[model samples]
Target: MGSEGIMKDVTKQGKATVLALGKAFPHQLVMQEYLVDGYFRDTNCDNPELKAKLARLCKTTTVKTRYVVMSEDILKKYPELAVEGTSTIKQRLEICNEAVTQMAIEASRACIKKWGGSLSGITHLVYVSSSEARLPGGDLYLAKGLGLSPETQRIMLYFAGCSGGVAGLRVAKDIAENNPGSRVLLATSETTIIGFKPPSLDRPYDLVGVALFGDGAGAIMIGSNPILETERPLFELHTAVQEFLPNTEKKIDGRLTEEGISFRLARELPQIIEDNVEGFCDKLMGVVGFQNKEYNKLFWAVHPGGPAILNHIEKRLDLLPDKLDASRRALMDYGNASSNTIVYVLEYMIEERLKNIKNDQEDHEWGLILAFGPGITFEGILARNLCA
Candidate 1:
């Protein structure tokens, strides 16, 4: 079928709209100013240079605090997790599977409550994670934990990195729009436990992970043709697109081994994304017949991969300073919870819009949600703010 034909058919019934959003974080909150001391002490690392480098990263990342699944109790229980060159994948998976599942259940329940719908009404589940590896995956565990219907259709996306949230939303949009009455609960959970390790010059990216990534889960309820009596539509999903830059696979790479997962990010990742984001976004907007729309006139929900990525995007698009307030606020409050970060950004946007509505202020109707992940993949979604 042709692209225009598919777009028409998809919107014939109605576009998928976000009904609600909720997020949850683990109990241990680490203050960035104190993270270096605790991290080094917990890992038994005495190298002053490595500690200094991490301290610098902590300040530069602009992350004030972050919640993590790892704690003194967990580190004490599984000392192997903090040891260098130790084969602790089994132990890591055990901790992460339980952590992610519980967080997912908590976030999902919050989302369902905000959605003002019975749990039984949800017909599908889309679970995304990059922190756990096990048989049956986190989806089955989440389904059981939430007491969802045994017949609920389930799809699990693993190792999607930072783009997993938007990727899952794209998947849920397809299911909701095509299946008529189907409502999808999209959940994303992540924990650094899977890749936690002692700071070493041999693996500089581990330090970056420590300074940036955090553990959390985010959930959103999605469905089309909302019943006005019960459902409140926040953002209408208009068009979604995914693309990858050529030969940039190595720029953002993660590998699973006996020691759990290890990630390596190139220094040029921010520059690479800045170079291509404009073209990618232009293409997505064109799909919805807004080819020449001004960028600043729309709301933005770009993933806060880090301070650098957000800065690069803001500059490249010539966006006003306030244009990325929600994104920056999410990063400051929660750090980058990988796939869960975008959910927090959207929630912040919604909350701000609600406040603005109360004060009789206006907001942009059209917005773009963007995220980058492994494979140098770019995910973009054009959405209309129904709440505005």
Candidate 2:
């Protein structure tokens, strides 16, 4: 086929669309109000000052509750986890590897069931996580647990941080669009277990992480052409783009140490993202043939990295108070589950739309999904609501 003919053939296959979304969380739930006492008790910390600081942070994060892999049983079983200077990397990895794999399997099963397709129909799997470090990785385990074909093409994205979910979806979109008849399952799972540490005066970021991060898994089914009889397209992904801000490499940093992974977030991180987001989003909107469009005309599914990041984006874009409701609600209910948080926000959007539909409310046809992570990366997707 000539270039034009090939282009026509590809176009006929259609853009990648989101057929379904599913999310799973660890069994242990912690309320923010009570977490301060338990955390201090678990770590055997006697510093009243640090406990007060964390209490304030929890309140400000707007996270009412969070799920975590860390529980009393596990902590009791592995007491070294809460100690200050223990080389517990092996133990942490063991716990997280199993936890993330199981969560991914549950989330994927929910997504496939919602997609109403046979497990054998999944042609590709894109698994994303930052909480587990192993040679074979969780993708292999997830595929086996889900009973996907041995030949299922698989790619694993590790340590993408908060943007992993959107990054995975972008990659899945390419696979589905390029390969006709492809059904891609994108699963993102994360836990704070690997990074959990005793609060220290030296590592203030650890407290911030304790206040902001949570554990969860999210899965999405993506395909270019859907079987109308058995599949329904929720969001049609039109364009996806990623950009790394210059001179901001040190804004967000994570290191793997003998103890476990450690993270540092610059106080100016939110400001840096706010400064660059408008231009980055404009680029994404331009690809969809919108120039200087009204921001409120479209819905938003932004990663709620923290209350400040969401507030910054809202203020920068001049968006309405409710423009980021889904993001805020997800943060309040689940905290920031790293890459998995975006999936929660998208799921919230889907549920809200369903409620709206029953009430005869209208929804916008176009929307955006945005996430930020290490590398100071910005991931954005221009999407259309087929269910509208």
Candidate 3:
């Protein structure tokens, strides 16, 4: 379809909104230098001088530290558990489930309370996660704990990796659209701490996995007016588009390893995104009936997958140098919170953008929410700016 045809199809409607959002972050900060040096020490590279060089590469004052569930002292207490080979399957599952449950509940409750909603209003619980997994997964636990409808439909989209948030939102939208009166509560909780394998230093890209990542959770409530209403809704869902590159599955893959789950970051990822982003975005805009230049006031709720991925997106999209400041700050403050990174970006916008919005009628604002992950896929959403 032509540009006008695309814009006509994807323009905003007046319903289906983000009623509320909430997030939880751990207290600890894993400094990049410390993490890099830890990896260098573990690798025992023949070139001693390379440690400083690698440290400088990973170091970023913009992302000074990352949060973790386990403290240094706590990790010291269970040295055997830190290694990949020492822990039994049951032990690993139990520990990870416990940590994820706690973080999920903390963030979920904060979100529900902030939005002034309750379990009674929720008809569905959807969770998106990649770091760890279990049956009856995190969403089931949330429904039970919150005393939500036992009949509440549970949808768990696991293993989508960093891009899970965008995909999850799409799933939630589908659910809400199908079940008109139902409100869907979406939560993304990741504990990379549980997947820590101290011996991954043999592979250079594996080093990137170990040095980056933190524990956190974020929750958002989405629904039609039939489900609920909010005095200050974040935004109405306009349209969403998702695309996957053919034969490029290896570009980004996360899977279970003996040490836990690990992510493979192929060096070719930057080039892959650079080559496809323009066309991918063009088609996405077609879905929403707009052009790239028309949607220039973008509040990039980008998944801070890694420094390299973010840099690649910046150059390919021709974004300003400081365009990803919020995402970069989140990486520095929280490391990569997986699906929660975009939530943190939304949080940042709430803090900064909400303040300046004129609380008046007839002022509909717009922005794009974008994220990418495994399948070498990309997802984009056109949203009516609630904060603006």
Distance from true location, Cα of 47 in model 1, Å: 1.0
lDDT of 3 by residue, 195-259 (tens): 66554336445546555677788888887552222335777777888999999898787667555
Q: Considering summed lDDT, which 10 consecutive residues are worst modelled in model 1?
A: 1-10
TM-score of each: 0.95, 0.96, 0.85
Query: What's model 2's lDDT at 132?
Result: 96
The segments of candidate 2 whose C-alpha lies over 4 angstroms from its true place after superposition are 1-11
lDDT of 2 by residue, 1-388 (tens): 1112222334478899999999898999999999999999998897878988898899899999999999999999999998899999999999999999999999999998898878777889999999999989889999999988899999999999999999999999999998887889999999999998998988766888999899999999998877776678999999999989888788898899989998789999889988998898888777767777478878899999999999999989999898899999999999999999998999888888887889987677788999998989999999987875
Better of 1 and 2 by lDDT: 1
- The C-alpha local distance difference test score for the whole of candidate 3 amounts to 0.70
Q: Judge candidate 1 against the unseen true structure and give its global Cα lDDT, from 0 to 1.
A: 0.90
Clashing pairs for predicted structure model 2, backbone only:
none
The whole-model lDDT of each prediction reads 0.90, 0.90, 0.70
**What TM-score does candidate 1 reach?**
0.95
